[model samples]
Target: MTFSLATWNINSVRLREALVLKLLDQECPDVLCLQECKSPVDKMPLEAFAAAGYNHVVARGQKGYNGVAILSKIPMQEAGSHDFASLGHARHIAGKLENGATIHNFYVPAGGDVADRKVNEKFGQKLDYLTEMRDWFRDNRPEKSILVGDLNIAPREDDVWDHKKLLKVVSHTPIEVAHFAETQAAGGWVDVTRQDIPDGRLYSWWSYRAKDWDGADKGRRLDHIWASSDISQSAHSSRVLRSVRGWEKPSDHAPVFASFDL
Candidate 1:
């Protein structure tokens, strides 16, 4: 079967429920993974998603903070959650689909403005998180898996509009980039989006700071869709829905999507 999967950092699922529903209608992805949902599992508006034909959901959430979720039209098994940095953030969730493929949804810490641990605790946590993630993948050695979410690091120079200018930026700093690369290599995960549109400027997020965000287009590829090497050949037709970022009251992130023949 050929099915589509999408990952979006909705910021807050409750606040963006309407937009989520609209995306369901528009994108028609078979499975949708969300990050930064910012609401407890009990508070999630399940009916809205169910009405949109997504009957299965597994999520990790907390009040006004980090969260991740997977919604599927097909039945799913609650695979698990993870605590990477021991920071107690609700940032990871996983599910196994009826098709026998596993999906991991994550929201990596943004690592604040300063890239130094002495002055920035969040930055330190981010590095620790990446280290733990790398070790976990090394141990588990997942196959037929799709790893996705707002990884919060732009690992490639082409991923950021102004890589040199953003060298001091939290997401594009050399340390974070190295750590992120290590995590990716540890899992042997093929960055699905990059595989489809390699060697070019690509972005899934744009800061709201710009007056004409679309015009200025100083964006970063913080969000990602990576798949295990075993299933990499089945992955295809990936794209970032930049139009969603233009929607009224939209989240800073746009959805990244891919199709796979399983």
Candidate 2:
């Protein structure tokens, strides 16, 4: 079977339900994983999404805060989820498709403006979260799985608009990148997006603070799609919908896409 999937940090799925619907209408990927849903599962617009032809969903959410979800046109079952750092935040969700492939959707903490954990509790929490994630993958190696989310870190130098300038920034710091690498190694995950587009200034997020976001073109590849080596070669057609950032009242992030021929 061949299916397409997309990952997006909708920021607040409730607030951007229309945008989600718009995306479903424009480029109907077979599965779409969303992060930062910012609403309780009961409050999510599942009815609306179902009406858009995505009938299956697995999600974990909270009121006005962190959340993650996976909506699919194909049959799926809720696999499970983890609290990672035990932060009790709704940051992860998983689903198993009929093809026996699992999908993990996550919304890792942004780590805050300060990279130092000394005075930054959120930064410390972010680090702890990743450490737990690495351990989980190390203990239970994944196969025939695809993981997608707003991981909130840019691991590659080309992932940022200006890597040197952003080295000290929260998302591109050396410590965070190292944690990211270790986690990737633990899972034996192949970056689907990077595998397709090996080089260039590829990015999926731009700050809302930019006065002329497109013109300035300052952005980061904070969102990702990763597949375990067993199914990595089945993945292709990866791309980021950069134009979505220009949508009316859009999220700072753009949707990233990939197709699997498993």
Candidate 3:
């Protein structure tokens, strides 16, 4: 079976329901994973998504905060969810497709502006969350799985527009990147996006503060798609829909995509 998947941080699903529908209508990915939905599951506009031909969904959500959801045209069953670090946030959810490939969607905490955990509680939470993810993956050792989400940290130097300048910044900090690396190692995950486009500065998110976002081109690769070693070889044609960032009242993030021939 061949299928395509896309991961996006919709920011607020309710507010951007139209944009989501637009994506479904245009791109028509076989599956679409969304993060930061910021609405209760019952409140999510699932009917609209259903009408768009996404009949299967698995999600965990909270009011006005972190949330994750997977909408798929193909059939899928809810696998599970986790509250890493006991942060009490709706940040993770999983689903198993008929083809036996499991999909994990996550929205990792974006460490606060300050990178120091000693003085920043949010930063500490972010690190703790990543640590827990690493430990969990080490114990479980996932296979035939694909993980996608807004992981928040940019592990590679080329992932950020100005790596040297952002070294001390929260997302590109050494500590955070180390933690992210450990998690990937634990799961034996291959970065599908990087594997396809191996060389260059690639970004999935741009700051809203930029006056001329496209012209300045200051961005970060905060979102990711990872597959286990067992199925990584089947994943290809990875790309980021950068033009989506220019959509009307769009989320700061652009969708990351990949196809799998399993």
In terms of TM-score, which candidate is stronger, 1 or 2? Answer: 2
Q: Write the residue-wise lDDT of candidate 1 on 21-89 in tens digits.
A: 999999899999999999999998888999899999999989998989999998999998999989999
TM-score of each: 0.99, 0.99, 0.99
Model 3 regions lying over 4 Å from their true place = none
What is candidate 3's lDDT per residue for 1-262, written digit by digit as tens? Answer: 9999999999999999999999999999999999999999999999999999999999999999999999999999999999999999999999999999999999999999999999999999999999999999999999999999999999999999999999999999999999999999999999999999999999999999998899999999999999999999999999999999999899999999999998
lDDT to native, each model:
0.95, 0.97, 0.98
Any residue pairs clashing in model 2, and if so which? none
lDDT per residue as tens, model 2, 73-130: 9999999999999899999999999999999999999999999999999999999999
Worst 10 residues of 1 by lDDT: 194-203
Worst 10 residues of 3 by lDDT: 207-216
Whole-model lDDT for model 1 versus the true structure? 0.95
Shift in Å, residue 78, candidate 2 = 0.2
What is the C-alpha local distance difference test score of candidate 3?
Answer: 0.98
